[model samples]
Target chain A: MAIPAGITGAAWLLRTVIDARDLTTEVAMVYLAGVLLVASRRSWGPAVAAVLASVATYNFFFVPPFYTFHVADPKFLITFGVMLAVGLTVSTLAVRLQRQADSARERERRTAALFAMTREFAVETSADEVARTLAAHARTLLDCEAQVLMQGPNGDLHPCPSGAPAVDDNELPAAQWAFHYHKPAGHGTPTLPGSSHLWLPLLGARGPLGVLGVQLSARGASLAPSQRELLETYVAQAGLALERVVLAEESARATVAAETERTRSALLSAISHDVRTPLASISGAAATLLEDRASVDESTRRELLQTIWDESESLARLVADLLDLTRLETGTLVARKEPCPMEEIIASAMERMERRLAGRQVRTDLPDEVVVAPVDPVLMEQVLGELLENAVRYSPDTSPIDVVLRREGDLVALQVEDRGPGIAPGEEEAIFDRFYRGAGSAGARGTGLGLTVCRAIVHAHAGRISASNRAAGGAVFRVEIPADAGPGTDRLSPAGAAL
Target chain B: MSPHRPASEHPPGVLVVEDDRRLRATLKAALAAHGFAVTDAASGEEALALAKERAHDVVVLDLALPGIDGIEVARRLRAWSTVPILVLSARGQEQSKVQLLDAGADDYLTKPFGTNELVARLRALLRRAGRGDADPTAAMLIIGPLHIDRAERRVHLDGEEVRLTPTEYDLLAALAKNAGRTVTHRRLLAEVWKDRSEEHAGRLRVYMTYLRRKLERAGRPRLLTTQAGVGYRLNAE
Candidate 1:
């Protein structure tokens, strides 16, 4: 009303200023212009109102006998009819144009939202992560609470273990139904309409992978048609991402299975050969002592008894080594890492091997300042012990063995060096493989699993262990692990008392 | 509970708790041959019942038992008795070894152990326990070439006075008090540092290193030895 009134009032002033006699058509043209301007900016209702106001103001002010609705000439009625017809046509076209612009904006918003969802899904590595990302997007876009429940191995619907809340108990049946049937159901659908949340199936290329449950806010009891479409697109992308994650996991499991199959056979052979050798010696010695009790002299009896003891000890060590290898390979041996001094680990390993090391010349070269590393004390000590045992088994007893601990860069390196026949050329890495005994150590008593176990422990600590022949005439095994602190007392305070 | 034989004439009693019957019988035979009046139990419940019936000189408890696991038994037993407990555990049970030791177990021996090792540990515990529960602070501790006069707060190595910082001295004294026995890391920490958290383990090792350097002479055997994942021992040989 105001738009038409203001435009016509300005036109009347213009006509009076020109003071022209035959400008009636010009005045009618002015009224038509007012109607078109109003219709372009507003909907049909406001545009129609602007047309009526323009006609009344044009006739009463500008036509002959202008002060009244009564017309002086019958020809003025045709002018009124033409003006009304043009106003209706312009308002209808303007209404259609306004709707097109509004729909274009809505489509752009939906496209941008879908693109954002797909971009986030591309980086998700697991189904749970995908589900979580999808749920967060749904909550923001749909203004509702959203959760995704995936199909389990047993064909049951289980909520993805993400930040999304678990599906309500009453709503789980609807979610399961949608997943089972691969169809949308629940609150806004025909099936299970009493449910508080709407359950939509995430349909992949093969079939449905999961169900997405959305609980609309109070004001959003019914989603607009376009929002419903966007929700469907979100579920579809989530399904594809979930399938990719599942396939990747399956392939990884297959690779691990094949690796386990290989090691299983190696383990069997190690048990049959290494374990039986000790058992044969232990049983033979015991039988000899038992059968010749009276005939055996004091010295002979002592020798046979000593053989039994030695073989039994070796058998115990083999069994222990095998058990450790199994635990490490199966991922059951969890390393409990802590900040530990390297000297302590070395000292502990030496103490544990004291009986075997008693007659050997073992020299330790420790840094003047202490080196501390984040390591599992027990497991790291085991690594050192295995290296020492290797040195004792391969090297001559009279030769000196050196244990050195040094700090290099961010790593702490512990090297066990021996003054004996070095590793055979090109056989250093092979020795760490399961049951790969050294060629020169023909008569050495070992399970052949010691170096393998050491490598596994080092890997568990995110470190590396390797064996190399020294230039001087010996083999050296070096282990490098991440250090928590360098050789200094700055980071650590005196523990017990003020020193 | 009364003993059939007089305390002075009877052999030192040992209660062996093992779930496996074969191992239990073997433990009984091994302890008997070593001159211990051995009583065996197949579970923690039976061990607790047997302990109440007779005053054993020592207890050998397996950590993996069917009923009332060894740690719980140790806790319940320590509530009333100060009897020495020697835990028998497997190789991978190092984490629990700290808990058992902290729960009042005197010491532990990993499984598949030699009878000689078991007898030695039991004897050391009996020796330490028999010296009475009171502090052995007034006496002189002579372990290998190192001599510690606890009353005088002084140490002499090969008749030469060895200088040690207060923390190093306190750590050495703690180990010396349990000479010839493996005192756990938790026990040593509590005794010297007044803290029992395993976090102080590295600090204890540093002090041990300092003490070892001070007391050790060239060409001589190291008197202080590490028990690997467990703790430390001062060899008195």
Candidate 2:
């Protein structure tokens, strides 16, 4: 490499002084070159050294009429003073510019790291997920093996295991101390300076989220001042992300708990009202009959007994449905799968509901071929009974109720159709909701849980149930259950299917 | 309606604690017809007062009283009297029923119970009170041709032992205890399904049918006669 312009000028001045030619010009030129070198180097100490070297060389080689260490003229002393001042001033300006450049680069790197970490945190849906992502990002940014130790229930440290090496007791203590104090500890820190890990606490808005332990590689002598600041920013962001996930989980749990409580309370009130009315009537009727056994005729006694029996039957159904609903909501309803003949279920439901549907005409269209499906007999009967009851209540007495059972593919479908006022538009879905009766369908004696229970039972059996207005008028409810003849069919007992 | 029929001549003095005015009146009238000296109370406080004023043989206490809950009323009544208390609760909460029974009620009857069952429960309670600590096994009850050995848990008709399901046996036993009186649907449900609420009348009916088939003779169901709107009556006479 060719000598720099400033160094070459210094050499030229030295030769001129050795020749004892133009001493004053030589000293001045050498001083200017020394100042230029100091400006380029941009250090105070180097600039001072250059000034002293130029003066010593000038005094020894060019200050005098011959090569000597003495200055002969006082005017040359003024030149030395000016050289020192100029070198110091230029070095100061250069050093300030270098410091500013370093600061800008540090800020840019920190900003970029923060943006990247925040984006990753934002996409994370769970606290453990965020912890893993934060630990990974921190490890890359800090250039160390980062481990996040969270505070467990009993004041113990729980380190997230996401490909991070285990931290020893001593190193963990340092991390725990930082977490407790919400500050940094160990190596390069005043607290436990000999510790190998740089422990930083993740301070959140509420409090400390956890401790972040970073074990540096041999290459990392000490974290730069700027790097320490960046580490703090990273911990803060990770803490915030963890806090958000914790809040989201807690809110979701609370919402579910509140919903369950509401359902329980409403069920209690409805059950109370329904149960009490029937009991009162039955009790009153029995007491009257007992007191007037002699005065009352046989016919009157029979009528009262019939009312009690019927009312009691209704009350029993309400209770069963309530229990079924509770089981459904709790996700505890177990379907007892058996190869039950559709005919038997239909016959039983019809026989049970014969008294209720006394005035209504019922039409049946069962194929000669026996259709079988894997279902709970009791539940299926309940589902069919509800459908039949709905038909009896909604359909006019003159119109006949149609129950059609057919097989399609590996599934069996049962559709109950009635000819009355068809379900209105937009009400098809609403009718299936618990406690929802269609508009203009007043005086319908129902607990409103019949369809809901039916749907829950159908769904539990892995079947699909839906309602739609029939083309011939009135409403049609269709239920399709998978056939049981296929492989992997497991038959469950009735006791196991109580729910 | 007949004042000449002395209160002491009645079967028993019953205190009916119900909040609904119409329901209370109907209960009082119905219970009166059964030859019970029925006293009506609208609130828990009134029930307590009425219970205290007289030596009631039986108390029909509603759980949903105005002043205090039926369970609380039962608890308070049990503190002083050994009267057979039948709790009437609208809520079919199993825990509440257990609590009430634990609080010293002899039996718990949910609301919407038929009069026959109510009377049957009352009769059972009265019969039980008359025989304190008596051996249930020693007493053999006969309903028409069907004979029940309470101690052995055996049933026989015309000297032939009959097999019955556990549920059927329980139903028959309940009916036999209240023989000659009506057993309402609600009481049957509560007795049969201890944890179940009054809404399980269908289950009770199914069991009743089973018991009738096993106990009743062919062509005649004289012992287990359906009281229609009331309840089943096990006629001893």
Candidate 3:
């Protein structure tokens, strides 16, 4: 490795050429090195050292007329001035570009981290699952041993296990304090500056979802301020995702509870009214026969049997009503709507209620013109029957019950009016509620689902039914169904209409 | 056989089936005093078994029982039998009457029924059963002094035609058919009301009272007799 004399002179000449280069060029190169050092490692002191050494080397080797500290040419003054200017300019440009690159890289990293966190949160079905996923992600992304501590109602941070050292109560308190304040604490933060763990609040719009406690290793102390900010962003995104999951779960539970309540109410009403009708009749008949056998002579005995028969028929009607209500409420009742004569439906209902309305005087006000409506025949008959029955039960025995049919533009209105005590004030709304009965109408035997059933039927037909006090001292129930074109324009005989 | 006018005459027998021992016993003794041959069974199984052994003109059955509920009993008895089955059940559970009838029970009576009402139902059922297979032209059919003309749907007492409503006439016709047998409440209702509800059995009592008042006008009421808790029976002899 010994050098020869001829090779030594060549080395010296090369050094001379290097020294003779423009001072500004030499300074520019040195400043460029400083900028690169700062961009890669972010060491302020090293960058400053590079700047000083580059300055000193420029003045000593490239500023003078030889290897001396003096300028032999005055023109060299402009060289020194330009060298300083160029050095500062290059340094500023280099620093600005490095900072821009670092910021862009940080944003990309945070965005990817946020996406990953959101994906994890979306797949989690339970609070515990969210907690575990959050903790695991925080540990990996934060590049430190991390723990997710959810604050319990009792103000305790329940640490989720990441298989790392558990965050102590004091550390958790610090984390909770940060969460409560929705700010970061410990380590580089203004609060608890010397602490080892970085306590970041998982802040969301509602509040902090939890706290993320990152325990940095010895090597992790070199994490820059920007790195902490990036970590905080990840924590905030995770918090928002967790909040969304919690809200969704609460709403789902509420929906299920509401559905269950509705089903239970329906079952109770059906069993109480529909199932018991037939049983009541059978019991009544047996009791009468057993009690009065001797007094009831042969002819009289026959009469008692007639009563039993009538009651049995009533039972069948109740069962049918129950089935219809169930089908309607469950959305299974399909209306096979067709253009049918309204008078036919009215006649059918009256015929069915003949025995029930035997004692009461029935007055009809039907126009000679045939009225028609688009409706399901079976359901329409049932609706009319219920309305008539309701009137019979409430109205005075001797009072006249009126059934009026009239056409209102685009709608056919069928009104059944009873002279019974009008529905109490404020009860009009409640009357339609399933199983709701009037206050003074006690001892009235009905399933109380009649009006509700009627409403459902009408709603299915896209029509309306309402009850109100009549202008003339009685309650009037009006059902307005959509008009339709149909045959049967020839009015039937009055006797045929009377049932 | 002709329709017999309502007169002061007693029915023959009635059948009662109830699970409660006290209720059944009380009904039987009461019915026997009313001139009915009161038959009783404590359970649906016992009732079915007894009914199979002998033909009862009328049967009063309770819906609730220890084994094979009353509805099932009605179904089984209806298979080969047209005997009137009257059902008894507690109040507030009136819906079972339809199921019982659909299962072949004729009629129903709610609990706490009056003794007078029970007798009237039995008589109606017995009268209807006795008229079985008889042509409408049968003449001069008599229950004591009461004479019925089937063709005219008329009844006569002491050689005078008695005025009667359509319901009253139908009632008399049912009793004349089952002259000797005890008829339960259910049979009478099934025949008269047809598709009418059993809950309106109270109306039956009102009608029977009207019939009795007309029949007892001569102060020698021999036709209608109350059979306490069981039912009414038309006397054959």
Best by DockQ: 1
DockQ of predicted model 1:
0.43
The TM-scores that each candidate's chain B achieves against the reference are: 0.86, 0.55, 0.53
Candidate 1: residue B219 lDDT (0-100): 75
Q: What is the Cα-based lDDT of residue B112 in candidate 3?
A: 63
Candidate that would win on lDDT: 1
Higher-TM-score candidate of 2 and 3? 2
How are the candidates ranked when ordered by TM-score, highest leading? 1, 2, 3
Alpha-carbon RMSD to native, per candidate: 5.5, 15.0, 18.9
For B77-125, candidate 3 gives per-residue lDDT tens digits of 8999888777887533433655675677655666666666677766665
Interface RMSD per candidate (angstroms) = 3.5, 12.5, 17.3
Residue A452, candidate 3: C-alpha displacement in angstroms = 5.8
Least well predicted 10-residue stretch by lDDT in candidate 1 chain B:
B1-10
**lDDT by residue for model 1 over B1-237, one digit each (tens)?**
124334468788999999998999989998899889998999888888998988889999999999789999999899999999999999988768877977888889897899999998888777767765335745787776788888788999888999888788888888887676677888898888788576667677778877877776547777877766777878855
**Model 3 TM-score on a 0 to 1 scale:** 0.36
- lDDT for B138 in candidate 1 is 56
Which tens-of-lDDT digit does each residue in A372-445 have in candidate 1? 78788889999999999889888887888999999998889999999778899999899999888888888877
TM-score of 1: 0.80
